[model samples]
Target: MSTRAPDRFHVSSAVVLCTPGAADRLVETLAEMPNVEVHAAEQGKIIIVIEGKSSGEMGATLAAISSLPDVMAANMVFEHAENLEEGLINGHRTDAA
Candidate 1:
């Protein structure tokens, strides 16, 4: 029997660069997104983390951020995920051992 679950937990980070004087506005816009968290913003660069249930959702979120006004560019810096069920199975085994 298979123990692995099909669902995935996805997390990715991206750096969004805004126009010279648009950093504050871009930060405010990014903060309104439910799945995106702005970690830092300085000058014209903002660091953000995006989380979603699947990779497709993450990609879509990134694309949306890139399209937001005042955003000059958005580039992904990191991506990682794991199957929740699989992680639980392995965790239980370790605990029992």
Candidate 2:
């Protein structure tokens, strides 16, 4: 018998462009979202990292961000997925296959 692991953990980074002087408000709003991290903000660009159980969840979050007022665009820059159970069992990363 075998037990299957849960869904892969998905991580993604995005560059969010906002209208002039909206970075501060956007950062504050993003900070309140679960599993979302604001890495930096300068000028009108905000760097954010988000984590989720699946790619669909991450994509949905990105879409929501892009639709926010003052947001000009939200583009994903990086993405990675890993099987946490496999990584933990081997004590090293065992990225999804």
Candidate 3:
């Protein structure tokens, strides 16, 4: 049997820094973006998760977040990608094929 590579999956965790007294506004703005989830907010910093089918999409979203008003910076803490087809053992797919 022949197998094909799986679709791309990208996940990124980032910390967005807000200007003084700007955390609330930043959180609201982030909430409006697609595939962006605000996990926590405190002391001018917001923890967020970005997910997309491709890394390029995630990067664009991150850049957009950084450009929002009162956003001081958006720094990626971690990033990961997985190919579903690669999760195989003994030439058998670990996940549903």
Which candidate has the top score in TM-score?
Answer: 2
TM-score to true structure, per model: 0.83, 0.84, 0.82
* Full-model lDDT, candidate 1: 0.86
| Deviation from native of the Cα of residue 34 in model 3, angstroms | 0.5
Q: In each prediction, how many residue pairs overlap at the backbone (N, C-alpha, C within less than 3 A)?
A: 0, 0, 0
Candidate 1: how many backbone clashes? 0
* Ordering by TM-score: 2, 1, 3
Q: State in Å the error of residue 37, model 1.
A: 0.3
The whole-model lDDT of each prediction reads 0.86, 0.89, 0.87
Whole-model lDDT, model 2: 0.89
What lDDT tens digits, residue by residue, belong to model 3 across residues 6-38?
677899999999899989877888888899999
lDDT of 1 at 9: 85
Question: Which stretches in model 1 have alpha-carbon errors above 4 Å?
Answer: 2-4, 86-97
Single out the weakest 10-residue window by summed lDDT for candidate 2. 87-96
lDDT-sorted candidate list, best first:
2, 3, 1
**Candidate 2 per-residue lDDT over residues 1-97, each given as its tens digit:** 2355545889999999999988898999999988899999999999999999998999999999999999999999999997756744434444654
- Candidate 1 lDDT over 7-68, as tens digits, reads 67899999999999999888989999999999999989999999999888998998999898
Model 3 lDDT, residue 74, Cα: 95
